[model samples]
Target: TPIKRAWIWHYQRDDRKIFIKIGNILNLNPSVVSRNFNKLERQGSDPDFYAKTSISERPRLITPHAE
Candidate 1:
């Protein structure tokens, strides 16, 4: 679930937050992870639906590295 954990870590950041440097978090293959994270970020569901299926509802362990 490294990727899912990573997503949670990133999700905790507020949009008001901007970074000059993102640090080593991007150590993974960028192209693939970026694509997948985009998929998660794209879930523009209504608050009620999104609330029903919160981040905690995600598969507890997902190591979906494209490599």
Candidate 2:
């Protein structure tokens, strides 16, 4: 799926400190993309499969920056 690939691409990139405008590129809602990103984050925990979604531990790419 494009979403999964996009997420992997995100994970692979070193210059992904900022969030990608997936909504602008794919025309999907950012919320949906975020939800799936959370899912991907969980799935990243291979054997344990017990990934926790913490506000502090979330990937920087998905987190909103303070201005």
TM-score of 1: 0.26
The TM-score, computed over Cα atoms with residue i paired to residue i, of candidate 2 is: 0.34
Every model: Cα RMSD to truth: 10.9, 11.4
lDDT of 2: 0.39
Q: lDDT of each structure?
A: 0.31, 0.39
Q: Write the per-residue lDDT of candidate 2 for residues 1-67, one digit (tens) a residue.
A: 1233334544543333212464445444555546555555554533222122345333223322221
Query: Model 1 — which ten-residue stretch has the worst lDDT?
Result: 45-54
Q: In each prediction, how many residue pairs overlap at the backbone (N, C-alpha, C within less than 3 A)?
A: 1, 0
- Our model 2 lands, by Cα RMSD against the true structure, at 11.4
lDDT, candidate 1, equals 0.31
Taking all chains together, each candidate's TM-score versus the true structure is 0.26, 0.34
Clashing pairs in 1: 1-62
